[model samples]
Target: MARVIFLLVAVVSVFQALAAPLHSRAVTSPQCSQFNVYASAAIDEARLSLGSINTGNDIGNARNILQAQLSLLDANTGVTEIADSLLTSAPPAPANASATVVAGLQAALASLNQIFFLADNTTKAAVAAANASMITALDNAQQAVAANCQTTLN
Candidate 1:
């Protein structure tokens, strides 16, 4: 009888130990991680693509890129809404998301010349100023997203 009871206790201990890891992981993996990852990818795209935009394009290529990114923003908000619906939800990453947002904004600034080429020097200065604001916003957003991921947003 003593051997039987000891064996039962050992088996239960092993089962509990295995189950503990699964429970902890489930707790750690917030649904918002999905949103964070996708959002980061979109931001990275903005960062990488910004320099490639041709300021002289009369065909609205830069405009198209901005529109595509804006569409991504819309999708990201949808993901956030779904994540929010869950109990004990993941953190919404306004902090991390701001970096890429700034990138898009910067792209918008550069795109100003494409929209209005012959404007005065003051107008060009305004565009340059807008570009600076975009860069700051984008960096802040990247940091915020990284914080939410807890492992950096990829």
Candidate 2:
């Protein structure tokens, strides 16, 4: 009777273990989707503003545009922080969203810094370098999202 009871208990325990809940993966996937959409939109708008900067001789207008781009970048940085927290804590299968965001942001900020220096000096070579850096940064951002962010941004 004692052996039979022990076997019964063991079977029940195994059944319970098999029925245990897994880490929820769907919970944070939406956040990732929203983040991808918002970040892409923000980057696109900033690029548009930056594109306009070279066409005009108005220093004041250019400064305003640059300030807008900076503001957008700042907002993106905040979103990135939120995304990092959400993605890292997500269970089942968490992607390295934080690393991707950090890399993209670092590259973008470096490009922006270089551009600011070039703008102040108005040197052709420096401007060319800044433009190339900006292009690379934008590409990095795209690749990061494509590689790290799994959710489709709708």
Highest TM-score model number: 2
Backbone clashes under 3 angstroms, per model: 7, 0
List the candidates' TM-scores in order: 0.31, 0.34
Model 2: how far residue 131 lies from native, Å: 8.5
Instruction: Report lDDT (CA) for all predictions.
Output: 0.45, 0.50
- Tens-digit per-residue lDDT, 1-154, candidate 1: 9999999999999999887842211121444355444454544454345444443543444464455345445434533432343323344333333344435444444554355452445434534554454455445445444555332222
Q: What lDDT would candidate 1 get against the real structure? A: 0.45
After superposition, which runs of candidate 2 have C-alpha atoms over 4 Å from their true positions?
Answer: 26-135, 143-154
Candidate 2 structure quality by residue, lDDT tens digits, 1-154:
9999999999999999999976543233554556555555555555554554552554534554455456446545644554554455433223554345445555454545543333443333433443454454445445555656543212
Best by the lDDT measure: 2
